[model samples]
Target: MKLTASILLTTFLSHVWSFNGELAELECPDDCDCHYFRVNWVTDCSDSNLTRIPYNELSPNVYVLDLNDNFIKEVEPFPPDFKVRRLQLSANLMSELKKESFAGLNYLIDTDFSYNQIRRVDIDAFDDSAGLINLELQGNPLDDVEGPFVAVKSLLYLDISNCSLKRLNDRFFENVTHLATLDLSDNPLFVINNNVFDPLSSLETLKMNNCNLTRIADNAFSALRNLKNLELSGNNLYETNWGVVLENLILLEYIDLRGSGLTHLPDGMFDNNQYLRVLILAENNLAGLNIQQTIGKLQNLDTLDLSDCNLTLPLSEDAFANATKIRNLYLSGNKLFASDLLLALSPLTNLHKLSLSNCGLSHLPDTFDKFKSLQELDISHNPLNDAFVKLLAPLETLEYLNMGYSNLSHLAPDSFSKMTNMRRLILSGNDINNLEAGLFGNLTHLESLELNFCGLRRPLNATLFFNNFTYTDLTELQLAGNPLRVSKTGPLLPKQLSRLQTLDLSNCNLTFLPPEAFYHTRNITNLILSGNHFTSPNDLKFLELLPMLEILDLRYNNLTTFSPKELTLNPNVEKLKLIGNPWRCDCSVANLWDWANLEKGNLGILEGSTLTQEHVSVGKTKRKKLLICNYDTGTQPFTIVMNKTVPGRRPFLNPQRTLTATNRTWAKYVRESGCEQQPSLKRVVRSADGYVSVISEDGIKMRYAKHGPNTWSAAAINAAVVYVTLMAIIGVAFLLTKKRRAAVRMVVTADKRN
Candidate 1:
């Protein structure tokens, strides 16, 4: 009896397992892949070359379905009781939406039909979508939109922007009472009626920018009492009384009126907006704004932007005197001098960030001492030099400074010694040729330094961070776009820079790497050395010591070979960039291929070689590693591969024995030359991989094939021909002299006989 019971139990368990397996397979559709998360399955059918929705193949367990980038024309009725909560049908050819299109999706909450041919949405299209909270109809030609979302009363966010909307009325938002955000930008609306937004009383943010609006009615925003942010920028508004229009928005905290032809800010414009914190008036013709009369009322203001305004009147002390709570002020792209700016900002003691970039400031005024609490300052695109930089000594709390594009050619020693608390410094886009040691020694807490686009010829000494036995806390340093060359002595990094994490030296015109180049930056993980002139394997021998390096960029260099012995990678390296190089695909580059394909390193080599007989141009060789080896012999080029038996499409490897021999020959030749070329014997380096490097007496190496159309080979042949022609000419001259002597002796003998 017990045995019988066991057999019955086994049968039941097997049946249950089979039923569960069927359910799991049923949820995954044939047209899409399903992935299960915490609650339900997400079906990804995007970019699947789909022409129509496989409604019958979809299971009810699918919650989120992505049908983006398809060729479907219309939104067919969904399956009955469809459990999909979100449906994406963007980038399709659908033109219109019918009323019963989404009738069966009872649980649908969001729908995206953007980037389609949608021209109209029926008023009752969303009648069954009472639970729909978000709907996107952007990038369509729905110009005469009247009212279609009356049934979508649960909507919270609506984006009908960029639909060529010309006008809006109260009927458009009749039932959207609970909407919190509305975006109607990129339209052609000329006038805004007062009661259009009256139904959306709970709206908090409204964006109507770039609408080509000409005028706003007197009480246009009087209905939105709870609105906190309003953007009316990029309009054709002119001579509009904003004070009366914005009088009812008592809860407004942010406003943007930029790119509007508002010549002036009328008096008492912001008097009612006591809680306003951010006000942007950029890119406007605000030459008549009396700062004291227009902006003095907002006592709670914290940030104000007035950039690109052609100010005609000089700012006085009374400007911004009432808005003492302002913490960030921007007056960039103006013609204000340092003295006028100082006078305007002398009363803003609570300011923390100030941008006076492109103000033509040549010097700092004495009134600049008022920025006691400032932590960030931008004085870029000016004419400030070392003298003006010294004027910033009073800002003890300053941490970030930008002085790029300022024509600063020199930085005197101890110029920035007073900014002890500074953490980041930007001096890019300058004509600085050199920086002395200890120029930033006092900034022991500095973290990042940028000196790109400067005419630097050599690396700065390590003493810049030698601050009384305490190493500088610098973590990032960028010296790109300079001309730091390789020195004969050794590498140019300080051993004490243990905290450094990132160093960018790209486009610096470097030629070589002295063995211990990066021995100091033990903690460095990212090193960018692209767009330089490093050509030989000897230039990368310093990478072996960097055990913590995670990313190494060697792109756009003149490198022709890569050997594991010279370019040893750390085990932690994850990415290696080697694009834009004249990679010679032969036994010489075998180690690099092995390293890239290794399983332990898991290195991602960007744009390595693929087997191809056709040679591509250097610039177009991205994602292709092809070369024209032995091409000038008037023969068809063959694909270089590791073995002859490998399939045409499979990757092959070079023999390790041949690869090691090629490397040994190269090293032996380099060592025999004493790492220096001999002056007497013209050094000719022959590689077993089928090329020759001719090193001149002056220690310059140029490569040429044994029999190919290389510039170096052509030049060498021409030189040999010139030497042979000169020797032949000298031999003929000697014979002529001997003949002349014999003729003269005969003439003397005949005279003696007479």
Candidate 2:
């Protein structure tokens, strides 16, 4: 089961001055930089080492002001007409929030004052900033009296968690009545007074998780009628009967009570939560599970997570008799016997995703076919061998299957012939070395196949994808950690993987690859060939066959220098992984170094800002490994010649890595790494008269190299052009000579007459 949570981790953002719509440029404060992000004018002043907020110097129309991680100690009032919408002031040194600190910022909607040394917050601090909607006061040591944000009556979201809050006074939220979400997690709040949260009648989500909370008055949350999501996980709620505490919360939809050290879930604890859809009771020390009382009363429960509850089975056949509507059930990390587990789960035919990993099972019940609606199944970390092959073939509806480290040894050739609907299959960490011909031929819809570390000993051949003519839809294939090396006389990759986009063959103990190794893989865009034994970039000649290749990973190879000339040949490739190699920052790498500077603006696109801290570009790089130069050239001034022009003819922006690009780290290395090139060697020409001589552009002789590859070169077109140009020059000379002769004859006749 996948759990996804989005926590807003506000980071430091340096600002530049620009309007949102027209993006008109304006002078920014010396301590700030601003840019237009999405639909707002964000001016980030973070990490600027400023002692105070640049309120007077900021743009009047700035919508977002980020001053995080600065040396500011006080919150000064903004300009009277400041229209800032989101203000971030995390990691500051302020000790107290004084009144009128944010007086005139009527347009401020979201603000963060987290991680400050604030020991007190005056109740009137937010009286003038009534328009603020979301407030964060986390990571503060606010031991002062409560009722701090009583003035932010319009606040809708508040995160006062992790503030070392021991207790909240009765009037803590006296004026904030419209709050929809409150996070009080990661605090030392030990007790809850009666009717403390009774004022938040409109609150929809309340999170008091991980607060070391031991006691709570029954009336503490007695008035929150609209509360829908109650997450009280990671707390000590063992002292109270949570059923009585949550008896009035009728609108609760999702409850996470994981790791609360409860021995049993009292009957009807969630009986009043008729709208509950998901219930998580994982990591609890429950003595015995009475599912009929835990989930039987809920008609809308769709997901139940009882993983790691130390649940053992001999469960009654009717344990989940009334909870048949649950579709996603997670029983992983439990030690249920295979037979008893399958028997208990047999009634839930509507299950779509079931995770039984680490359940110590050696077989898959053929009865799984009864769950015709099941799509995703994970049985990893079990001892199930090939005994479960045919048992799983009946589940035609399964789309995703992960059987990693299941002690699998071998399977029949047509083991998965019936699972044509499978989209992703992971069988990594097994001993199934040899694959039969047409093994995956029937899985036409498979998109991702991972077989890493499967103990394959022989070089791959066509039989791996043999007769799989319709398997072109596979986009990702990870065969790393296997010795799938190349042999001189072995078979090449089949053309069936023509449409494959990403292929990983890393750590494959590969030393050499023939030039035509991947000649059939034309559309692969991402290729991982890292952790190999390639000593030179020339060993990557097979890349020429991958015209559509873009991202190439060559890390941990025995490479010394990657010639920029190779990069010039492969223009489509952009993001390169050359880390973990002994890279010499010299003439052989200078052009690539310069090229990477121009290209690095494309990396780190996961963030809104690119790596360059300059202009944004398209085609973001996905690799996170930073390329470092291993050989540090000393500060000695040694002369080295650089090529005036790169060999290939292409535009300056794209293929040519020789373009002048800025590298902020260039000062650390010697610029004299640019060295001179050897003089060009004269080609040997074998003349038609049987004598060898130096080559000329004239159309008589054929040139030979010091080595031969049993291949011939064609010069038909170039030879024809050279011959035509020579003929035209001779014709022009003959015409001029004829005219001079005629003039001389006329002069001689005239002299004879005299």
lDDT of 1 by residue, 97-179 (tens): 88888886778887777778888788778778779887777777884866634557888877777888887866789877899
Residue 441 CA displacement from its true place in model 2, Å: 2.4
Candidate 1: residue 427 Cα off by (Å): 0.8
lDDT score of model 2?
Answer: 0.69
State which candidate has the highest lDDT.
Answer: 1
Query: Candidate 2, TM-score vs. the true structure?
Result: 0.70
lDDT tens per residue, model 2, 477-523? 88899977467642256777777898888899988788777776778
Q: Over 4 Å off in model 2, which ranges?
A: 1-22, 29-33, 48-57, 127-130, 148-150, 431-433, 452-461, 480-493, 504-518, 525-754
Q: Give the TM-score (vs. native) of candidate 1.
A: 0.68
Alpha-carbon deviation at 273 in model 1, angstroms: 0.8
RMSD of each: 29.5, 19.6
| Poorest lDDT segment (10 consecutive residues) of candidate 1 | 613-622
